[model samples]
Target: MFKTIKNDLPASIVVFFVALPLCLGIALASGAPLFSGLIAGIIGGIVVGGLSGSKIGVSGPAAGLAAIVLTAIGTLGGYENFLVAVVLGGIIQILFGILKAGVIGYYFPSSVIKGMLTGIGIIIILKQIPHFFGYDADPEGDFAFFQVDGENTFSDLYKTLKFITPGSALIGFIGLGILILWEKVLSKKGKIFQLVQGPLVAVVVGIVFYAVTQSNEALSISQSHLVSVPVPEDTASFLGQFSFPNFSAITNPDIWIVAFTIALVASLETLLCVEATDRLDPHKNVTPTNRELLAQGTGNILSGLIGGLPITQVIVRSSANIQSGGVSKMSAIIHGFFLLISVILIPRLLNMIPLSVLAAILLVVGYKLAKPGLFKKMYDLGWKQWIPFNVTVLGIVFIDLLWGIGLGLAVGIVVILLKSYQNSHFLHIEDKSNGKHRISMTLAEEVTFFNKGAILKELDSLPRDTFLEINLLKTRYLDNDIIEILEDFLYKSKERNIDIKLVSKRGIVENPSSFIKFFNERPKSEMSLS
Candidate 1:
């Protein structure tokens, strides 16, 4: 790790800049003390990053969990009580790791995961727009469609246009320009530019912009539009900011319920992020998902002990780490130390950075995540993949993160069921010389309840004066629901003037009576022809 300090140090600095505002923003969104976000950031970086098997994944207070945290805190009666839940949640997550439930992450469809990344990217860009223009009514990191402030995402953007601050907008444009230059021009020119990332330059320029415009009333950015870290007047006041969990709340049934909710949600988010970060890793390094859960659980436990929000493997910060050239876990660990040291020594300096400038940096990050090319790429993959991918993106944009993913997963499942239905059987129709239709239906190897609909549809559509052959020679398992459909169809066959022939490994049966009785009398392992 020390050998890569040259690379890791610079990458860590970039992640620190990226993480600083987010820590405060997520806390603000969660309705927790602003300092709690920073605390989570510190523990996530130092403790979780140190223990996690992921070389590039970064853990922190997730924006995705902000709504849950906000509601959990309120439901639990107080922030201290909520801390009890966080700790318990951590224990549950640790149990999840022990049970090897990390395999659940692998079950999420690739299309859904890609949709998540794209959706989050789009949300980041959309949510940051108001901040970029100096509208400070909504908190920085609140990405939900319906905000805690009672305004919807797009409505807030429209409202922000009416109250734009000149100073904030000016600095934002300047910061964005500097970032664009650093990445597109300067970074390629020399090692110095590469060593100093665009975000760091943008932050420094924002601070200088803030200081220079302090006296100009119209051009002045208000404190509300600036980074707001809890500045401690004294050591005692700083220490007072950290709150401990109320162990007495542990016995409360409500606390356990909240704990379980957080543990389940946080574990899932972490596992998804682990998969995403590994996919984004340039080297394609796979993180051990179970070990990641354990690391996150431990981080959440420490974070809760010190008045912090729940921690998860955050895709935004992890993606920022990867994009900024983070090569190892050292970058994540160093960033944590940066969070620790900066809050202690240079918080006031951090407070000088304009939120708009940070917004500009995030704009670039968002663009990278939701690039236009991804749309075309998904489209090129065909409707089967594109439908779920597009739905997930739209769901995240219009709804919340988890809901959008759930919606996409639902759609993906529907697509799978449809495919299964279509593939369940093959129908061949032969026109015989006797002016009758001879149809042969072959079942797939494994036919489930989902195949029942398609099979019934074909059977019902058969015309009169037809000879139908039901072939089950290749079928290994036929669902009982399908058997009932065939048994019922046998009675209709006579009324429709349709001749029935059933073929299976057991032999052929022509116009057999009591189809159900015949099948029920045969061994389940044996094929029944009736």
Candidate 2:
């Protein structure tokens, strides 16, 4: 892991800059103590990173869980009560890992996964717009369409025009310019430029800008629009910030319910992030999904013990890590250390950095993820892929993260069923021969119950005085539902004056009396000609 330290070190700094405000913002969004988010970030990075098999994936307090955490805290009675749930949730996650349930992540369709990444990118872009203009009405970690502020995603954008802070907006543009310059020009010029990332530069400039303009009333950035890390006056107060879980609350059934909920949701979100992060990695390294669950479980347990929010492998931080050239788990561990050391040593300095700079950095990240070219690429894959992709994207924009993926997955399943229906059988018709219409229907390989409707519909549509040939030579395994349908069709064929012939590898049968009995007498295990 240390072999790539040169790359990982720089990437870790970038991720550190990215994760800082997010930790604070998600905690704020969850209505938990501000320090709790930072704690989650620290534990997610160090503990989870140490145990995880992912080379470039980063874990943290996820924005996707903000709503769940918020309600869990209130429903459980208090933050201390909520801590018990988080710990239990971690245990549940560990069980999930031990059970080897990580394979469930592989069931998600590629189209849905791509749609998820694109939707998140678009959300990041939309959510950051207001912050870029210095309107801080919404927390940076609130990614849902409906917000706790009662002003939804779009409404906040409309309101931004009325409340934009002049100083923050100016500095935001400057920060964006710096990032763009580094990405498109400066970074390409030298190894030194690559070592010192653009986001780190923008953050430094933002801090300097805020410090210098503090005296100018018209240009001074307000504390409200800056990163808000809780400042501890001394060691005692700092240590006091940590809260312990209420063990008495463990007996409460509600705590168990909340714990199960967190375990399920956090595991799901982590699995999804692992899938997406692997796709984003330049080296295309595959992370052990089960190991990731175990790592997250351990992180959440430690985080809960110390009064922190629940942890999950976060796509935003992971993607930022990969894009910034992170090649090992060390980047994640280093970022956690940065979070811990900074909050302990220089939280005051962190508070001075403007939020607009971070927003600017996210805007670029968002753009890269949702680049217009991806739309065309997905579309070119045809409606089977395009419909689900678009549906997922729209659902995510209009609803929330998980819902979007769910909607997309639903659409994708429907598309698969439709394709199955069409491909179940190949029907070829010939003009009148021997004073009768002739139709040949060939069943597909491995026909299942899903193909019953299509086959039945075709059989029912046969004309009177038609000669129908049922070809099962290509079919390896025929579903019982379809066999029943074919048996029932025998009665209809006689009534319609339709002559029937069954063609198979065994032999030709003239209007077989019983489809089931015919298959039962033959070799059942291997139905194919070969």
Candidate 3:
């Protein structure tokens, strides 16, 4: 970790810039006091990052959870009561980690994971467009289709035209230009260029632009368009920002429900982001999902106890870190320290950053994730991959992250079922044997209930006086449903004069007695035939 400090330090700075506005914006979106978001960010960076098995994943307050936090706060009676849920949620996550529930992340199809990354990319670009042009109507971290501000994603883009700020737009354009130059040109020029990242320079220039043009009314960036870290007067006041959970609420059934909700949502989001970040990592490090859950759970527990919102492994910040060339977990850990120090030492100076500048940085990150090239790439993979990929992207863009994933997964499962139905059995007909029509059907390696229809169709279509040979020699799994179908067809075969021969690893049987009884006596649901 120490060997990568040079890369980690600069990457950490970039991640800090990317995470700052998001932390505050998410808190605001959740209707929680703004400081709570910072607390979560700080803990996520320091505690979660430190504990996580991932080399590049960064954890923090996520926009995905903003709606849940907002609704839970109100429904649970107050912010304090909600903290109890957060705490319980953390405990549940820990339980999930212990139970190895993180394998759930692996069940997601590759197309869906790619779709999630692309969808999030599109969302970041769309959401930041308004902020980039200095229209700060929607908070930074609200990634949902419908926002807490009562405007949908596209409507917010439309509204940006009506309320654009000249000063913010000017600095934003300059910031974007600097970032492009730094990435495309300057960073290639020298080691110094690589050491000092473009985002930091862009942020510094944005601050200067904001500072120098204060007297120019038309060009002055307003405070409303700046980073909004809480400015406490002294140590006591700074400590006062922390809020403890109402432990008494632990007894409330409503609190438990909220707790389970937070745990489920936070764990899922973390797992998904873990998958995404691992994909984005240049080093191709695979994060241990169970360990990630454990880290996130611990972070939430600490964050909730200290008056913070729920936390998760956030993709935006993690992607920003990766894009900025972060090579190790140190970057994530250091970014947390930066959040802690800056909020305490130079919050006023930190507040000088224009929102538009951060928007420019995110615009680049968004474009990288949702590049147009990925679409054709997915398309070339064929419909099996493309359909689910497109479904996930559209679902995310139109609905939200989880909805998109769910829809894409549903589509993926359907595709699997269809393929299964089509490939359940291989039927071959031979020349009449002993003056009787002969048919051979070989069951697939794994035949589930989804294949029942195809099998039934073939069995029903067999001609009278047919000699049917059913082959299960290579089959490893045969669903009980399919077995039942076979048993039911026994009577029909007799009436149709279809003499049946069953062949399996257990050897040949002429018209087996009771398929149900045969399988029920086996050691497992799936046949372990050798």
Candidate 4:
């Protein structure tokens, strides 16, 4: 861990800048007190990072949980009321961890996971477009195509086209230009650019531009362009910003519903981040899934208790961490410190940085995630890889996040079963010379109930005047459903001139006992005879 810290120091700064706006944006989107988002970011970084076994996974306030938190706050009558559920959620998460539920995250297919990252990348790009144009209504794309206020991404973009602010848009373009310059030219200049992060430069330039443009005489940047951490006057005023949880609202069924919602979403988002972050790690360190859950669970509990929004291992921050060259948990911890120290030391300075600068940075991150090359690479692998990947991406882009993954997983499962079903049901038909047609049903190595439909379909379609040989020589185990299917087919075989021959371990059974009785009476060796 210490060695990783030394190697990833540069990456940590990049993650810090990337995470800063996201923390505030997600907080703003969640409708919780602004401090709650910062607090969640702090805990996700320090606490979750400390406890998480993954080398590169940076934890924070998830955009995925914004809807849940927003709904929870409203249903609970106040943000404070939602806090209790968050704590409960954390406890439940810890219990989940103790029960070793973390293993569940590992079982998802790689294609599905990659699809998820790519899908999220596209969402981030779509969501950030509004903010880059300085439209700050919705919390930077909380996973819906349509907004609760009835203005969705497309509508918002249309609105931006209709009413673009001159100052904000101009500054936004400048910010984007600077970022591109940093990434393309300046970043390649070696040690100096490595030492000075691109986002940090964009943010600084944004602040200087804002400070100079404060007066409307020569330059007029509106409020929409600025970073929106609520401006508190003094230290006591800052502390006054906290929202107390509604303990009475804790018993409300809606709160529990919200809790379950948060838990499921946060867990899934965390798991997805864990998968994506591990891939991005330069060292290729594999983090323990159970440990991550426990860490996130604890972070959520703390966040809820402190009137902060729910936290999860977010991919935005994790990807930023990886791209920034973060190699160790230290980058995570350091970024948390940045979140904590900045909120306390320079609320005024933070308020000066434009949302456009952050948006510019995210645009870059988003582009990297959803790059054109990724599609071609996956497509080149063939349909088995392409179908699920594209399906997942399309599902996420058009529908909700989890729903997309679910649809993809469902497709993947169906594909697998189709392959298995096709592989298992084997039939050989022959027209015999001596007024007999020989047919053989050679069962697969292991035949389960899934093969019942295929087997039955083939058998039902068989032509008349066929001699059937029931071969179970290669079969190690037969499902009870299949046995019943075979028994019922025997009566059907009589109708078609299908002379039946049963092959088993004990040479050959001329007229085998009843399906159940034969299996019960026959020794294992006898049933398995070749």
Best by lDDT: 3
Which segments of model 3 are wrong by more than 4 Å?
433-435, 510-526
Q: Worst lDDT window (10 residues) for model 1?
A: 521-530
Candidate order (lDDT): 3, 2, 1, 4
Give all candidate RMSDs, comma-separated: 3.4, 1.9, 1.8, 3.2
lDDT of 2 at 453: 80
Q: Pick by TM-score: which candidate is best?
A: 3
* Candidate 1 lDDT, 1-530, residue by residue in tens: 78877788888988888899999999999999999999999999999999999998899998889998999888989999999999999999999999999999998888999999999999999999899999988887788999989999999989988989999999999999998899999999999998888889889989998999899998999899999999899899999999999998788999999999999999988998888888889999989999999999999999999999999999899999988889999999999999999989988999999999999988998899999999999999999999999999999999989889999999999999999989999999966748778999999998889998899999999999999988888987777888888889999999998998888787888977766875677776764332
Clashing pairs in 4: 11-324, 80-244, 80-245, 80-246, 81-246, 505-529
Window of ten residues with lowest summed lDDT in model 2: 521-530
Scanning candidate 4 in windows of ten residues, the lowest lDDT window is 521-530
Q: Count the backbone clashes (under 3 Å) in each candidate.
A: 0, 0, 0, 6
Where does candidate 1 stray beyond 4 Å?
Answer: 1-4, 431-436, 463-530
Write model 2 residue lDDT over 153-257, tens digit each, in one string.
999999999999999999999999999999999999999999999999999999999999999999999899999999999999999999999989899999999
> Candidate 1, overall lDDT?
0.91
**Any residue pairs clashing in model 3, and if so which?**
none
* Alpha-carbon lDDT, every model: 0.91, 0.92, 0.93, 0.79
